[model samples]
Target: MNQPFDSDLPNIDAPAIGPPTTDPVPQPFEVKFATRVDRLPPYMFGRINNSLYQKRRAGDDVIDLGMGNPSDPPDPSVIQKLADAAADPGNHGYSKSNGISNLRREVASKYYRLYGVRLDPDTEVMSCLGSKEGFSHMCLALMGPGDTAIIPSPYFPVHMYGVILAAGNVVALDVADSEMFLRNVAYTCEHMAPTPKVLIVNYPHNPSSAVIEPEFFVEVVRLAKKYGFMVIHDFAYADVAFDGYRPPSFLAAKGAKDVGVEFTTMSKGYNMAGWRVGFCAGNSEMIRGLGTVKGYYDYGMFAAVQIAAIVALRETDTNVEKQSRIYQGRRDVLVSGLRRLGWDVTPPKAGMFVWAKVPEPWASSMSTMDFALKLLEEGNVAVSPGSGFGQGGEGFLRMSLVENEQRLRQAVRQISKCLG
Candidate 1:
C-alpha cells in the first residue's frame, strides 16, 4: 500500500503570500440566488411616498392618506397592562414560541363568546407577532415550489407576495363584485394548475373595504371542503366595521374548522400596530402547521406584549367601536366632499380605506402612479396609487380614513383646487 500522505501536515513554508494581494480582482459571484428570488421586484411599494414626503417637507401641505396606520391610541386599560407587564423584571426574557397560554385561552374565550365558535385554546389558537406574519408563515408552511395558492386580487398585496416568496404560484381571483368573486373562486378550483393548495380571503378588506357576509363564508367553506384546499381568512379588520354591521367571523360558518383558519390582529382594532400582537384560530391542523413553522423562525411576540394583548382582547371592544365611529365620520366627510367636487367616491362599508376611481379627465390619460404623483405635486394630497396593490387596482386610488374629518375635508378641498 502506498504510504498514506500526511494530509494534516501544514504547508507553512509555502511561498509566504507576498503581503496578501490587495483586494484581488473582485470576482463575479457565481453562486446566484434562486431564480424565484431573482425574479422578485427590487422593492414592493415604490418610492412614491418618500418623494412625496420630501416635497411636502419643502412647504407643500400634504394630507397623507397613503397608509392605513391608525392615528389613535390604544385603550387606557390596555396601555396600563403593557406598562405593568413591562415593569416586571422577570418578563423580559425570551417568550414562548407559541405565545403565553393565557393569551391563547383569552382568544379562545373571546371567539366562543362573540362568534359561538368553540375552540380548544391549546390546539386551535396561536398568538402571532402580527396577523400579517401569521398569514405569511402559513403560506410558507403549507406550500412548496410548484404549489398554487388562490388569492383574491385588488386585495392585500402581502397575501399574493407571500405565496410567491414560498415558491408557489398565485391564482388571482378578482373580488370586485360579490357574484364574480365567488364565481372566480369556484372557477379557480375547477380549473387551475397543481390544484390550488391554499385559499386566502380577507374580510373588512383593505383598499376595497368589502365586508363579507355569513353567506360568503358558507360558500367559501363549501368550496374549501369540495376542493380539499386550506382556507386562510384574514380578519385583520374584523373589529373595524361601522354602522352596526358586525362582520361575520369565518368560524361562524358551519364546518369552518374542518378546513379553515382565521387571523385577527390587534393592530387595527386596538391601535396596537407597533405592539405587534395578533392571533390565528380555526382548523387545528393548519394552526399547528403555522405554529411549527413559526417555532423554527421566532420566539414569539414579547411576553409583555402578549399579556397586554390579553388585556386588549378582554377590554378594548368599546375603544374599537369608537375608532370605527371615527373612521365612519371621516369616511362620510371625505366621500361627500369628493362627490361635491365631481369625483364619485364610494363610502367604504368597513376598514380604514376609501377606494375611489380616478376621474375622467385624468383616468384615461394617466396611470395610477402618474395621477397620484401629479396630485401630490399639485394638490399635496398623498393617496395610495391603486396600482401599487395589483394590476386590477389600476385607475383607482386608496385613501386611508386615518386622518381627522377636518383634514379629510381639507384634502378634498385641495384636490378641488388642483382639478378645477
Candidate 2:
C-alpha cells in the first residue's frame, strides 16, 4: 500500500464511505418557475373553500352558496342529441380544431336571429372548449411582454389572470357603477402604460351583476377606435337577465366589428358547464388569431359535444327562459329575507350572483376573507368573498343563486341567526 500511494485514494479498510464527491443534489424543477408565475398570490378562495367542503363532508349541514356552478341539466332535446351522436360509431375521432362547419354556421344563424349581428360562419366564428379557454388563448395570441390590457375591477379572475399568464400588464378600472366603468375606460386611455393594446369587458357582470347599455358599448367602440385597442367582451351570462331588461350585444354597436369580439358560453344559459362548449364571434382577424393559437395546442372539443352544443343553441332558449325565471324568484326571496333580518340587499337585475355589502358591526373589523371564514364556521353557509375578484371588491360578498329558493332562504336565516 505504501509503494506508490496516491494522495486522493481512500484506504481500502476505511470504516465508512467518505462524503460523496458530487455537487449537491439539484433543486427540484418546480423550484424554478417563470418570474411572472412566482409573483402571483396563492389562490386563497379556492384553497379555503376546498378545505371547507371537506369539513362539510364530515357531518356539517353546510349550505354552499359560494361557487357559480350551475346545478341544472340541459334540455331533453340537447341531451338526446348528445346521446344520438355518441351512439354513432363513426363519430368517435379527432374533431376540427376550428370547430365543425355546421356548428359554426348554427352559431352564426342564431346570432343573426337573436342579436341581428350577421357573422360569416367560416371567417368570424370559432368554437372553444369553453369561453374561459378561448379568452385565455386569445390573450396569449394577441398580447405579449410589454403590452397592456385594460380590465374592469371586480371582474372574473380569468380576465386579469389571462393577461398576466400572457406576460402582459393589466390596468384594472372600476366598473362598480355603470357611469364609473365608462369614466375609468376613458381615463385609462389617457393615463396607462404601453397605451393598453387590449380592453376586456363583461356584462351581466359577475359579482356586481351590472348590465351595460348599447350607449355604453358605443362609447367603448369609440374608445377602442381612438386608442387602437382591441375589445374582448365576455358575454357568458348573456341570456340570464331578469325584469325585462335584456343586456345589449357589443356587436350591435356601430364600430364593434372594427374593434371588438364577444364570447358566449353554453355553461350559464344551458347548464352545460361540465360540457365546456363556447364560441367566439366577431372581428375576423381576432377569431383567426385565436383559432391559429388553439390549433397548435388542442384537437378542439369532442365531436359529440360540439354536435350537442348545436342542439343546445337551437333548442334550449325555452329552458334558459325557465332558468332565468327561477333565478329571479330566488333573488326576490333571498333579498326579502336579508332585508327582514336588518341587512339591506338589492336584487340583481342580471347574472346568478348577488353582490351585497357586509353589514356594520363586522364591516369595520372584518376583511372579506375573515367574514367568509366566520360564515362557514359559525353559520355553516358558504359564500364567495368579494376580494377574490380583485382589490376593489373588498368589503363586499357574492351570494350565488345556483341554490333553490328554499336553500337560499335557509342561508339567509342562518346568517340572521349568526348575526344575533
Which candidate has the highest lDDT of all? 2
> Model 1 misses residue 315 by how many Å?
1.8
lDDT of 2 by residue, 266-312 (tens): 99878999999999999999999998899899998989998998888
Each prediction's RMSD over C-alphas, in Å, is 4.8, 4.4
Q: Clashes in each model (backbone N, CA, C under 3 Å)?
A: 0, 0
lDDT of 1 by residue, 289-326 (tens): 99889999999877888888888888877787888888
Those runs of model 1 whose alpha carbons end farther than 4 Å from true positions after fitting are 1-24, 27-32, 42-44, 56-59
Model 1: which ten-residue window has the lowest total lDDT? Answer: 39-48
Highest TM-score, which number?
2
lDDT of each: 0.86, 0.88
